[model samples]
Structure formats: C-alpha cells, structure tokens
Target: MPKIIDNLHEKIFECSLKLFGEYGYNEVNMKRIAKELDIAVGTLYNYYPNKQDLFFTVLKKSWQQTFFKLDKVKETNYSSRKKLKYSIKILYDEIENRKGLGKELTKANVIKKESLDGIKDRLDGIIRNLVEELKKEEKIDIDKEIEERLIRVFFLSVIDMLDKYAKEKENNIKFINYIIDCNFK
Candidate 1:
C-alpha cells in the first residue's frame, strides 16, 4: 500500500511538472493537473494542498535536477573556458526550452520576489564555484569580489541577450566565447 501511494505521488509530480512547464503556474490549476494524471481532485489535494505548494515543489525539483547537471559539468576534465561554456549552455538551453513558461511566470508574477532572489543566489553560487575552479586552474587572477561581479555581469548579459535574440544560436556562442576569452585570456 505504501508503494502504491509512492507511485501515485510520483505520477502527480510528473504530471505537475509537465503541465507547469508547458502552461506555466498561472494557467495551470490543481484540477487540470489531477485530470492530466487521471487522479481525483481530492487525491491531488492530499498530495499538495494548494497550487502554490505544488508549484514550489515542482520548482524545487527542477532546480535540483539543474544543479545535478551542473555538478556533473564541474566534475568533467574540461578546461575552465569549456566548463563555463558548457554550464552556460545548460542554462541557456533550459531557458530556451521553457521560454513560454518562463515568460508567463514573470508576466503573471507567479513566483514571489523573494523566491526569485533565492533562485538568483543559488545560480550565483554555481557561477562562483565555476569561477573558483577557474582560479584553481590558474586561468583567472582577480579578487574574489571582482570575480564574482564580473561573473554576475556576464551571466546576466548573456541571459538578456539570449532572451531577446534566441534564434541567433551561433552568434550567441560566439559572443559568449569572445567574452570568456577576453576575460580569461
């Protein structure tokens, strides 16, 4: 019985992720998610009392998956520039793939402002780790504060450009490579 309950919970989470990723939090409701999972609304509520709870649960899981991938990239035997590129590519791909849901969440203010800050802080920590790895590789020599600032600027600029001109994939890579070279070289 516990195993069956676990399976039902997993099904709900999977269905919620799909619906939330495709339709955004504002447009998706518990009823829709339950229907998509072929579960009763009461069962869905038993798992997640409210939409916000379910949304945050899914968001937390997605962030964990992203961090796991980034951690794997960090473990790779690649050059600092290559590592940074791969990390950025991972982020860029995620953003591009979920552009619609991202825009919807932003436009609808579905996520709280403080939650956004938390997400930014987590992303910055990943960048900081990358920068630290680069430092260990003797690829960059700068004060910690300056390095962090530069990373923040570069990351934000790249995201902005990608959001604005997502179709220019090659150009984006070139632009990112240029920045990496100019900074680390």
Candidate 2:
C-alpha cells in the first residue's frame, strides 16, 4: 500500500518558492528544499527531476500569477495612462517581492532564451496597448516606425529600472512619469 501525503506537490512548491526567493538559485538545492518540507529528497525528485526543473516550474507558475493580474489591469476601464501606470506598479512590486529572482533565473540558466523572450514579448504587449490607446486618441504625432522604437525603448527602460532598483518604488514611479511626460505631454 502506498502512503499518502496530502497536498505534497503544493507543499513542495510553496517551500521551494520561499526558499528560492530568499536564497536564490545557486544557494538552494533539492536536499535543502526536502528538508524544509520534511520530505525525502527522492520524493522531491519524483515531482521535479532536478533543481532546474523545479526552479523553472516555480518561475513559470509565479509568472502566470503576475500575468493574470496584469491581464485584469488591462481589462479595467481606466484611462490608458492609468492602466499603464497600474500595470507597471504591479510589475515593480513583483520584482521587489521576488528579490532578484529574475537575476537568479538568468544566472542559473534555468530558463531558455526563447522562454525569456516570450516573457518580454508579453510585457511588451502591455506597453503596446498603451501606445495603441494613445494613438487612437491622436496623442502621438510620431511615425509608426518611430513609435514602435520608442515603445521598445520604454519597455527596456522599465525592465532595467525594475531589475536594478526594485526597492526604490518612489524613484521608479517618478522616472516612469518623466518618460510619459516627455513623450506624451
């Protein structure tokens, strides 16, 4: 007869997420996660083949939640600028709370280049929506090509700042507004 452990997968994921966010990719391992969950390392392996697999799973799951929230913000009836600002706030908070998880993923080589690009594409979609909205309002005087380039630059700037200074919420918001004012005002 097999012994049953209730919600073991969820338990493992929760424990792993907390550990990974706290200690980062290189600093964590199956044994430590198992120990934290009071389970055998082999049991963890039964769920996730290796550290990379586990880490990637946790990252994908976490990103899904973030994407979902961003989706909700996208659907809101707010002004385009307000929606963009709220979306950015959500992303900034995610980075601050994750505490270098992005760096860990990049440094550990856990996620593929294409997958990272997919994440960027999704974020860009959020920003692009704002551009579309502004264009509809006839607020953007730039040509399409220049508008696209600016969108990429703006997205890159946001990502850079969020990754580099996640803890500085005030400054980041101000920087975003500066970009918005300079471009749209």
Maximum-lDDT candidate: 2
Q: For candidate 2, lDDT tens digit of each residue in 111-166?
A: 66665666667777877887788666656676778778877766556657877776
Error of 2 at 45 (Å): 0.6
Candidate 1 Cα errors over 4 Å, as ranges = 1-6, 99-108, 112-118, 139-146, 157-162
TM-score of each: 0.77, 0.83
Model 2 lDDT vs. the true structure? 0.77
| Consecutive 10-residue window with the lowest summed lDDT within model 2 | 102-111
Query: How many collisions per candidate?
Result: 0, 0
lDDT (CA) per prediction: 0.73, 0.77
CA deviation > 4 Å runs, candidate 2: 1-3, 105-108, 143-167
- Candidate 1 per-residue C-alpha lDDT over 62-147 given as tens digits, one digit per residue, 9 for 90 to 100: 66777788889988999876898888888767656655544433443686667656656777888877777777786567776767
The top-ranked prediction according to TM-score is 2
